[model samples]
Target: GAGVSQSPSNKVTEKGKDVELRCDPISGHTALYWYRQSLGQGLEFLIYFQGNSAPDKSGLPSDRFSAERTGGSVSTLTIQRTQQEDSAVYLCASSFEGLNYEQYFGPGTRLTVT
Candidate 1:
């Protein structure tokens, strides 16, 4: 089965541009999550979708960061009007339902803003 995947392992952009990062999670997984990790920073939860409902969005840095999941499998995180401050390694993970389930992470998309 596919573990998880993210595209453009790296991305460089100028300020005020828009970029979209993609994530493909494993099949049969009903829980998915998006997170961002800045240099030397812990993983920050961006959004979480269990099935099709978003129950959390408290960690999104700003209005520029948004994400959506389709068919409960693939997800995309879009950053609009990029700023240098938005630079970070975006990580996506998926897990099984129930407690003590471990999340599998993708390689991550590193976005650099100039």
Candidate 2:
């Protein structure tokens, strides 16, 4: 089965511009996650979604960041009014149903705001 996939493996945008990052998780997966990793930094959980449960957006850095998952499948992360500090690798992962499960990760969308 195909694993997770993300578009625009690299993105360069100016401050105040908006960016939409896409993610395609494995087929039949019910759990999906979005995370951000800065240079020489650890992964930061941005959101987590499973089935029809409400998404956990506690990790979203600010109001400018938002995401949505449709039909318990693909997801999109939108950054409104991007900033220089928004430069990082946006990673998407999916698991079976539990946090203990092994989460498969996508290639990631690297956004460089300048």
Candidate 3:
């Protein structure tokens, strides 16, 4: 089977610009996750989606960041009013039935806000 995939491997946007990053998870996966990796922070959890519904979004840095999964297959992470602090490698991962330890990860989208 195919692995997870993300779009716009690298993105450069000016401050205050909004961007939408996409992710396509492995087929039949019931769990999806969005994480961010930055300097000093190895990897920070952003959101988790279980069957098209996100049960927890507490890891999001601020209100400017949002995420949604559809059809339990695709997900999008949107950053509104982007800032330099948002520059990082956004990683998407998927697992079957909420199993975090066996998740397959995408290459990630590197976003740089200047």
Candidate 4:
């Protein structure tokens, strides 16, 4: 199967606008994760979904950030009312099982909020 894929490799938006980022995990991989990386910073976990279980969203920075995995394969991360501080790269990863397994990451989407 193919590795994870993300759309719109780059995005530039004004403050207060909304944006959506998409991720398509490898077929049969049941775990998906979203992460954010700011300039010079480490990857920050944003959300995770495993199987049919409840998604772990504790890592979301605020209510304005949300994500959903449809049919357990594709995922979409939405950021509302974007701010300058939100400028960064959004990464998506997936594994066969959980965090214990090796994760395959997609080329991140670089977002610039001004």
- The candidate scoring highest on lDDT is 3
- Model 2 clash tally, residue pairs: 0
Write model 4 residue lDDT over 4-102, tens digit each, in one string.
Answer: 999889999999999999999989999988999999999999988886454567899999998987898889999999989999999999899855799
**TM-score of model 1 (CA atoms):** 0.94
Candidate 3 lDDT (Cα, 0 to 1): 0.94
lDDT of 1 by residue, 14-47 (tens): 9999999998888887888888999999998898
lDDT (0-100) at residue 101 of candidate 3? 59
Task: lDDT winner between 1 and 3, please give it.
Answer: 3
Off by over 4 Å in 4: none
How does candidate 2 fare on TM-score?
Answer: 0.95
lDDT (0-100) at residue 101 of candidate 1? Answer: 91
Q: Give a tens-digit lDDT track for model 2, residues 45-94.
A: 99888874545677999999988888888888999999999999999998
Which residue runs of candidate 1 sit more than 4 Å off their true CA positions?
none
Query: Poorest 10 consecutive residues of model 4 by lDDT?
Result: 48-57
Q: Poorest 10 consecutive residues of model 3 by lDDT?
A: 95-104
TM-score: which is higher, 1 or 3?
3
Per-model TM-score versus the true fold = 0.94, 0.95, 0.95, 0.94
